[model samples]
Target: MKILLATDGSSHAQAAESLLTSLPVPSDSELCLVAVVEAPTWQSDVASEHAALREELAGYRREVEERLEREVERLKSRFGRVSGVVLSGNVVEQICQLATDRQADLIVAGARGGSKIRRWLLGGTSDRLARHAPCDVLVVRPRDDSAEPARGLKRVLVAIDGSASSRGAVERLASLPLGEECEVIVFQVLAVVRSFRMDIVEQSGDLWEAERRQAHDDLNWAADRLRPVTPHVRTVLHEAEYVADEILTVAEEHRADLIVVGHQGRSRVSQFLLGSVSSAVLRHAESSVWVVRTEDADVS
Candidate 1:
């Protein structure tokens, strides 16, 4: 498999790199390490700072290139066949172009990069890459001090709500270039765990235990459906008040290095609302996340 891993030197970015070490890519498979540098623009008010800013920007680019070189060297030692490519341009645009030009099978990146709030408000670089890239994408989170990294995906946790998008996530997981020894933990979370119907509002059920059992059964059924793809898979059911919290908990308990989930488009009304659990997991999980969305009109 040919894979492109993008980094920006953030801890979250390196977390993505760490996850790749556990993937079962063949020793002969190719890996590309790319770090993009967006040309710095000077403000009119700070015109006098142009030369200084340019120098500083050039220095930063050199630093990133050196970092990429070292990382590629380390990766080649592990994967046996890997190369590095560094470029200066718009981060998201450059990554997409590189992935398409190289016919990369997968593009890996950090879930949240240098600016989380900025990305959230103005659309994240990772989010844009995922939407526009030609191949599958793996958006990994930084290692959280509160959580320990999984040795490997001992048990994979998948979130399915019976959507084709979610199903796509399952299919992608089945096709991952993983080692034969790896196992899977398939599961799902009910976003609205409880809903009150008092007055006109729907409320969450008080029978939380029963809801949990039902959720478990749903996940079990999904796992059974995936048995053909992976015989070593297990099923889990979780019922929590919030989706993201439940996912992180399950990940910590199962020690999952990779979390596979399908992307459900956000409604316009909800776009400004709290981000989805998958996004939250991307932000918080001490693991790699693969978000499967419907194949777009643009096919590489």
Candidate 2:
């Protein structure tokens, strides 16, 4: 496996690095460490007048490169092949392009980065990468100072709908080398959509019951697909108005260390419900999130 890790030397980035140690990767796996230095947008129009600014930018870039080198050296002790690079440009684009160029199987990054305003308006680096990366993206949240680090892939929660993308997420989890002791919980949420008050009082009751049964069956199907990967597989069917909220609630109740979901699921009335749900979970979940992109997705 080839993994690309994007860092900005923040505590969140350090959390991602710490979490990498617990993942079950092949012994010969390679790791690529990357850091991006943002080029200053405010420079004098005249080239001669901007010489000092260019020098300052060069110095900053060198510092970033040295930091990445140190991080790579530290990770080399754990991974067989570790390398580092410093890229200059937009953080999200450069990271994604590097991941594609390296043919990375997975991209690991922190949920939040150095810039607050950009994260507020444009979403964090991890959020954008999860949406656009060619491969699976793991968004690692900073661990609570008082909490203990995970030992291994102990408890995992996966959100599943009947979409091909959701099944793709299941397949990806099944392909991972999670140990026998790993426990996986397959969760599916049934959203109750009501058009009118009369529907809510009359038609909604029967519809809810029917949906519950179908959700149970769907959860079973997802659990079966994951059975070969681990024996401790469980399933949960939840009925809620908000799918993402239910998912996060269950994950917190289960104390899940990782939450896995597809980037998009079946479209309803031409709207992609899973996309919004996945985005919400990515932004708010306390556990690490693994956003799986289907093979049919336009990775470019």
Candidate 3:
């Protein structure tokens, strides 16, 4: 597997690096380290080309390059096939572009660190990276950031929604050759619209049964895909008003290290207008999250 890791040398990024050493990815997989140097925003198009501001950014870029060189040496000690690149521009955009250029199978990053304006793995940056990255993006919180120590990589929670999106998440995960010790939970929630109308509620009992049956089928399909990684696959079907909340609950109950989710492939504004489940999980899950998009599913 080709994995691209974006780090800023912050404590949060360090946690992500530490976690990477324990991940289930093959030891021989190619690992690329990327550090982005973000320049200050310009008030006008001409302002960006101003010589003074250009010189300042160039100096900062040199500092970042030095730091990246040190980090490369440190990480090389951990990763077998490792490389580093220093890019100048938007953090999220540069990372996304490099992932596309390198055809990375996954993009790993840490959350909430560095300057507020330049934090690469939270707020708008994390949201955009999850939605726009060419492949899966894994967001990890620093261990200290969590109230409880995260469980090991043995267990993972994958939320299935019976859509191409959910299937893609599972497919990407199954592609990874996780160790035999790994355990996977294919979890689904019965999401039925609530209707106060007695007639509508009574009429939907049969449909609810059909939904449960379909959930089982989807869970089985996910199980088949995951069995290659590990035989310890289990399925859970639940009904709740907030699917995201229940997903976290299950992950916590099972002590899952990672929560795998698929991008609904909806833009933020579109989701605000449409629906939410995957997005909510990405935002709220205290555990590490891996978001795979349908576009990344078939990337061999």
Q: Among these predicted structures, which one has the highest lDDT?
A: 2
Across 151-176, the per-residue lDDT of candidate 3 in tens digits comes to: 34778899887767788888888987
TM-score of each: 0.71, 0.87, 0.84
Cα lDDT for residue 3, model 3? 90
Q: Is candidate 2 or candidate 3 better by TM-score?
A: 2
For each candidate, C-alpha RMSD in Å? Answer: 5.8, 3.1, 4.4
177-265: candidate 1 lDDT, tens digit per residue? 44446677877765542335463223334454555566666566666666765567777655456767787888888777677876553
Ranking by TM-score: 2, 3, 1
Better of 1 and 2 by TM-score: 2
Q: What global local distance difference test value does model 2 have?
A: 0.80
Better of 1 and 3 by lDDT: 3
Candidate 2, residues 55-156, lDDT tens digits: the string is: 877887777788888898888878989999888888889988998898998999877666321231216567788888888899887557322346677899
How much does candidate 1 score in TM-score? Answer: 0.71
Q: Give the lowest summed-lDDT range of ten residues in model 1.
A: 265-274
lDDT of 3 at 246: 88
Top model number, TM-score: 2
